[model samples]
Structures are given as C-alpha cells and as structure tokens.
Target: MSTYKAPLADIRFALFDVLQAETLFSRLGRSEATRDVIDAVLEEGARFNETVLAPLNRIGDEIGCSYDKATGAVTTPPGFREAYAQYVEGGWAGLTAPERFGGQGLPHALGTALKEMIDAANLAWGNFPLLSHGATEALLQHGEPWQQEVFLKPLVDGRWTGTMCLTEPHCGTDLGLLRTRAAPAEDGSYAVSGTKIFITAGEHDLTDNIVHLVLARLPDAPTGSRGISMFIVPKLRVDRDGNVGGANGVRCGAIEHKMGIHGSSTCVLNLDDAQGWLIGQPHKGLAAMFTMMNTARLAVGLQGLGLSDRAYQNALRYARERLQMRSLSGPKFPDRPADPIIVHPDVRRMLLTCKALIEGGRLLGYHASSLLDVIEHGGDDDERAQADALLGFLTPIVKACLTEWGVECTYHALQCFGGHGYIAEHGMEQLARDARITTLYEGTTGIQALDLVGRKIMQLQGAGLKAFLELIEGFCSEHEGNPDLAEFVAPLRDKAGEWQRMTQEIGGRAMADPEEIGAASVDYLFYSGYVALAYWWARSVAAAQTSSQPDAFKDAKLQTARFYYARILPRTLAHKAAIDSGAAPLMALQADRFDA
Candidate 1:
C-alpha cells in the first residue's frame, strides 16, 4: 500500500482554474483569504494529514475503537486521542469558524477543501472534527447568544467534540417517529430522555466533553416532525461561567458493530433525565437540526470523495508497478520480464473512470462550497438569497451524487488491484467498506433523491433548478463559438435543455399521481447528478484549453474531460429512460410482492 498524498496540483486547478475561487473570495469580501494564504493552508494541511493521519489509517481500521459498557466510555484506536489533540492545537477546528468564536473565520469554500484533504487522509479520524463542524454549524445558525458564547467556542477550538443525535431505534429517516422526550425543568432547563442510536463520535476520548444536538418531542409539542424540538445536551455539565461541572445524565448504552469506519466510535446514547436547553424555537427542532444536517450531508459526501481519491491513488500506483502480462498493442516494458498492468486497456478503463470521477466530482463539490461562501459573504441580500437557493438545490445532488460515484470510483480502483485488492493487508477492501455507509447515512440516497425531486424542485417550484440551468446556459453561451470548447459546449447546452424539459415533464405527471414523484425520484436525482458533473467536466476542459500550464497537466485534464463525456455522461441516458418510465412498473407490484 502507498501513503496518501493530497493532489495539490489538481486541487489548485479546480479552485483557481476551473472555479476561479480567489476571484469569488475577493468579490465576497473575504479579504483575509488571499490565494497565498489559501495555498499555505493547503500545504500545511496536506503535510499534517499525510504524516500524522495517513499512517494511522490502517491501524484505525485494523484495531478499530474499543468501548467500555461498564463506564460508558469509548476509547479510540492507538494514537487517535493524541492525533486529535494535535489537530486541536493546530487550530484546525477553528479554520472556518468566526474570529470572535476563536476560529480563523476563513471562507467555508476554502475550509471545505481543507476538509476534503483531511478526510482523504484519514476518514475514521476525520469523523471527530466532521461531527464537530456540523454541531458548530447548528449552534452558529440557531443557538442563543449565550449558547454560542459557551458551546461554540469550545467546539471551534476543538476542546470538545459534537454529535447530532436524531435517529432513534424506531426512526431513522422519519423524524416524526422519534420517541425521545424533553420536559420543562424548574431551573429553566429541560429534562431530556431519549435513546439516540447510530450516533457517530457520540462518546469518545478525543474530547473531555461531548456536545450532543438532540431532537426530542416536548410536552406541548404537536405530533410527528412538527412537534419535535432541538436540544443542547452536554455529556458533561457546564456552568454559566464557562466552567465544566460533573457528568450529565447522558451515557453510552452501547456501540455499533459495523463493517467499516471502525476507528470512529458509533455509539448508542442514552439520555436519562439529562439536563438540556433548547437551541431554537419550540416545535421547530426539525428545522433547526437541518442547519446541522445540510452541512453534514455535504461533509459525508466528502468522506466518499476522500476515500475514492485515496483508493485511486493506491490502485493507480499498484497498477503501474505490478507486472502482469504483455500489452495488447505491444511490449511497452521490453527490458522487464512482463509489462505493467497499466499497459492493459481494461486497467486503463478503471483508472480513467476513477480519475474522471474524482476530478469532475472535485469541481462539483468545490463549486458548491463556493456557493456557501456566497451565502455567508455575498455583496448584497439578493445575491445571498440567490446563492442560498442555489446551494439548497445543489446540496442533495452534491451529497447523493458524489457519494454514489465515490462508491463506483472506489470499486473501479479496487478492481485495478485485481485479487490482491480483496486481501486485508492491501487496504483496498477497507475503502469499499467505508464507502458503503456514505449513501446510507446522512440521509440515504433514496431520501436525497426524494428531496431533490419533491422538495427542491416541486415544493420550491424549481427555483434552484432554474438557477443551475441559468449557470449552465451562461457558460455555454459564453463559449459558443470557440472551436476548442465547441465539442463540450454544444452537448452541455442540449443536456441543459433536456434537463429542464424532463423536470417539467416529471412535475406534470406528478400532479396526477404523487407516486410518480417517488418512482422517478432516484433516477431523476442520478440524471441531475450526471448532468451536473457533465457541466463541471466541460468547465474543466474549457479551463484546460485556455490554461498556460504544462502540456502534460493540460492534456490530462482535456483527456479526462473527453473520457467523462464519452463514457460517463452517457450513463445519464439510462437515468432519463428510467424517469420517463414513470411510476406504473414500480407501483404495479404491491409491497408483499417485493420479497416473492
């Protein structure tokens, strides 16, 4: 196995060349985040992850985390705690946080890039900060001023970690089914009682205290999701003076036994009369939790992105070095006994697939982050509102598409290793295992698909869809006659038009039968994702065509763009066909008929 190295060149190309992030940063009034500062951050982040975290990837997976039922304490694999301390001391947790809250207050666009690097280096270890970032988002958005003063700073500074406790034993996707309860207490606190299962980093030795953002029903709250309220329940109590008190009523009943990401402790949290406080208005906890969830969904997508990148790097290295048989064309390595696997066309297919997905997905993910920067720092309210709408539209696609593609890309990477990939010592299987969960958690692909089709498109009346289509059209129109980009520009415009038409068609059919939405949703989501990636790939080719970079780098970008257009973009056809098929074939079979 090879050590993970951050693809700094491609990252820079995506940020500067494809997305023009520095220009956007300046326009957004983020003067502190100069290109030089951002570059330095990436360099240092790469160094930290490559050295400190990369080496621990295998150990984290092999040894995993150990949990103690007696004390409700979870111990991370070796070096996990010390590594987290180093992360905190380096001020990484505060990178994108507000300066007043002890963060560097950098644009989340840049922070998201740094996050991708960290996740790619060590995903299991990355969960600690990932959850913390989500928790920070919720508090920053909806927490009371005092709550921000106390909880936000600690989490930002990494003195403590956080977890979003939403899923209960009975309810995973349906928040309305949650059985957790929160009752009013005399001291102005609420008595929280609930069991939140599948809580990542819920109980860990990485921090002294764990901040849990739990969703529970209040006494006077309505039924279902509407009745739920968001609560701030700390594992260790804290006073008004920012002092740590004794342990709260929260305990880890058990930890889950999982296939991958074993290093990150996934705990079953028991909140027995736990002292807690509300973050947002009552009966609106679902909305408040979404503040964290939106950020988390994207973060989970990055997990998939990171693992795919890591797997590709390792598999590509192995392919180049591993001697197999003679190439189909000729003997490329005449001096050696046999040619490397890279000489094989089939192997190249796998390598190119991984490369194209990562590079294109990088552009898609980074562009979404830039939109986030616009939301936080845009010049005017209108621009911010537009940015918000665009971000909301892209979130589900970014979360679902990148993750699903991550699984596909990783599978290709592993196949490049052939039989050796299956063995544990090679570390390829672990990537596949870690990737399986990304689509399931943070809202499953099905749920994200539903959100994209039903909520974002239909409910919002295609506000986000229109924004995205306008972006694609603008780009296509800008590059209308350029011979260099003509190949990409034309197809992209056609796809954009088709996407809009498909959206309208689905909306029309859904009006007659609501089941049409669910039936077409997953395919529509995939269709949207493919089209979105095609736009990014075309943008990359356009950037490469006009760049002053070396021929090798520019050629690689153009070639990969071509590969995406030719091989990957066509996958959208199947998705479109599935969407056009509508709800009949799927709904024709009753629930009981599925098993039979």
Candidate 2:
C-alpha cells in the first residue's frame, strides 16, 4: 500500500484554489490559519500520523483491548499508552479547542485535514482520541462556567480525555427510552447510576482521567427525551486542588469483541452512584448531548473520508505494480509476462470511482469545515449565521454521504486486490470492517437520512437547504464558459435540478402522507450527496485554473480535477434517477418484505 503523502496538492486545491480558504482566513482575521500555517500543520499532521500512529494499527488489531473484570479497567493494545502520552505532550489535543480553556483555538479546516491523515493512517487508534476531542467541545459549549475552568483546561491539554455515555443496550436509536438515573447528593452534585453499552473510549489508560458525559433522568425530570439530562461523570474524581482522587463510581463491565477497530476499547460501563454534575438544563439533556453527538457524526464521516482515500491509494498501488492479463490494444509492458492491471478498462473504472468519491468527499468535508470556521471566527453576524445555518443542514449530509461512500469505495478497492485483499496482513480487510461502523454508529444512514429529509431540509421551509442549492447553481452560472469543465458541469447541474424538483414534490406530499419521508429517505439522501459531489468537482476545476501558484504542480491538480469530473462524477445520475422514482418499487413488497 502507498504510504500517505498528505495529498497536499489536492488539499491545497480544495482550500486555496477552490474555496479561497486563506482569503477567508485573512478576511476573518484568523492569523493562525494562513496559507503557510495551514501548510505547516498539514505537514506535521501527516508525519505524526505516519510515524507515531500508523505502525500500531496492525499490531493493535492483533492484540486488541482487554478488560480486567476484577478491577473493571480497560487496557489498550500495547504501545497505545506511550503513544497517547507523546501525542498529548505535543499539545495537539486542543487544536480546535477555544483559547480560553488553554486550547489553540484553531479552525476546523486544519482539524478536518488532520483527522483525514490520522484516520487514513490508523483508524483503530485514531477513534479513541477523536471521541475525546468531540466530547470536550460539547462540554466547553454547554458546561457551567466554573465547570469550564475546572475541566476544560486539562481536556484541552490532553492530560484528561472525555467520552459520551448515551447509548444503553436496549435504547440505541431512541434516547427517549434510556433508563439511566441521576439523584441529588449532599455534596451539591448528583449520584449517577447507569449501564451504557458500545461506549467507544469509555475506558482507556491513555489519559490520567476520563470524563464521561452521560444521559440520565432526574427524579422530577420530564418523560421521554424531553425529561432526560446530561451529566459529567468522571472515572477518577478530581479534588478542588486539582489532585487526582479515588475512583468515583463508574466501572467497566467488559469490553466488546467487535469485528473491527480492536485497538480502541468499546466498553459496557456500569455506573454505581458515580459522582456526577449536571452539564445543562433538566430534560434538555438530549438537546445538549446532540451537540456532541452531531459533532461525532461529522467526525465519523471524516473517518470514512480517510478510509476511502487510503483504500484508493492501496488499490491504485496494487493495480500498477502487479502484472496481469495483456491489454486489448497491446502488451504495454511488452517484455513482461503480462500487462499492468491499470491497462484494463474495468480496473480503471473502479480506480476512477474510488478517486471520484474520495476526492469529492474531501472537497465537501473541507467546505463544511471552512463554513464552521467562518461561523466561529468571522466578524459579521450575518456571515456567521449564513455559515452556521448552512452547515447545520449539511452536517447530516457530510456524515451520512461520506461514510456510506467510504464503505462502498473500500469494498471496490478491496476487490481490486482480488484474493489478497481478504488476508490479514494486506490491511484492506481492516478498512472494510472499520468503515462499516461509521454508518451504524454516529447515527445510522437511516437516521441521518431522516434528519436530512424530515428535519434539516424541511425545517424553516427549506431556507437553509435552498441557500446551498442556490450556491451550486450560482457556481455553474459563473463557470459555464470553461469548455474543459463544461462537458461534465452542464449535465451534473441538470441532474441536480432534477433531483431538487423531485425532493420538492416529495416534501410537499409528505404533509399528507408522512410515511413518504421514511420510504424514500435513503434515496433522497444519496441523491443530495450525489449533486453535492458534482458541486465539489465544478468548484475544483474553477479553482485549479485560478490557482495563484506556479506551473507543474498546479497543472497536475487541474488534470486530477478533470479526471474526477470526466470519469467519476457520473455516478450522481444513477442516484438522481433512483430518487426521482420507485418509492413504490421499494414499497411494492408485501408485509413479509423483511421475512428471511
């Protein structure tokens, strides 16, 4: 497999060329994310992931995490503790954290790219800290003022890590049905008691302290999701003097033996009167938890982005190096027994699809990250609202679309390896198993689709969603004259418009037939994901042409942009057609449709 190169040219194309990300940085007065700064961060992130993190992946899966039932502590695969110690000592833990809490307060753009590098290098190890970053972000936003001073600094510094304890074994999708409980204590805190399953990073030796954000119902709390509240339950309680104290009440029952991500522990946590403090308003816990959950959903999507990129790199490498059947035209490697696999049309097609999806996803992911940066750092409230509202609608898209395609891209890339892909050492099989959870975890594709069609798109009568569609249309209008891009651009725009019309029709019909949303939700989600990618390709071509830098490298970017549009961008049409019809085809099956 090809070792990661950071894909700097492509990342530069997305930011400086297509999105003019540095311009936004300058305009927003974020002196830190300048072009030089971004380039440096990307370089360092790539090296850290490649050197410190990647080597542990195969070994991690081999040894996996272990639970000591007697002490109820989870131990990660060997070398993880030391790796995490170095990672924290480097001050990388708070790259995106707010400065007030000792964070670097950087924008999401750098974070997004950095995450891709780490995930692609070693997803199993990467998942552990990713959860902490997200959980800390939520606490910083909603935790009490004193709580920030007490907790945020250590978390931001990576001395302490965090986790979200929301999922119960029986209540995976429905937070409203969670049975965890919280009661008042004499010490002005709450005593939390709950059992949470499938908790990633729930128990680990990577940090001195593990802060768990749990969802529990109070004595007088409201019923359902409305009655739930969010609490901060520490594994090892902290004293007022910043001293690490005794175990509170939380313990690991057993770690799950899953098909993938074995390096990271997924625990079933049993909280026996754990010392806890409420993070937000009573019965408003679900809302606050979603803040972290949604953030996680996006992180999960980026996880997929990284997987697809690495998978493509691996497959593309194998295709060229390994000799295969002779080409139709002629044996390109005339002296060899056969020809390079790249000479085959089907091989090229698969390669092209993987590239299109990964690159397209990279574009979309970065754009979303930039929007978040603008929302947080920009001076103008209107600009911030525009950025925030737009990202709010796209988060589900970013999370759902990229992860689903991540799985698809990995499957195709693995197939290119033929029988070799399925083996343990080849590492392709790990990508497949690891990428699968992204869909089911961090909200399933079904839930994300429902969030898109039912909540995000329809909310405010489609104002935020319409704004995004309009943005894509505006780009087409501006770039209509570029002939090289026009061939790919025009058809994509038409298809997008077709999908938009179908969605409008279905959305309007949804008022009378609520089930319509559920029936076509996945199709609609995929349809939007399809056009969103087209928009990325179009922007890429425009930006690559307008690149400020010089010759050889920029030309390569323009070529890759063309490759994406010409060879890979057509998949959107299939999704559009699926969205435009056949809800009945899906519904046509009898009541025993699921009977196996």
C-alpha lDDT (0 to 100) for residue 569 of candidate 2: 57
- Give candidate 2 regions above 4 Å deviation: 1-3, 239-243, 548-570, 580-596
* 492-543: candidate 1 lDDT, tens digit per residue: 9999999999999999999999999999999999888889988998888888
Per-model lDDT? 0.90, 0.82
Model 2: colliding residue pairs: 222-227
Assess every candidate by TM-score. 0.99, 0.95
Write candidate 2's Cα lDDT for 313-360 as tens digits.
889999998898899998899999999898998988788888878877
Cα RMSD, each candidate: 1.0, 2.0
- Each prediction's total of clashing residue pairs, residues at least 3 apart in sequence or on different chains, is 0, 1
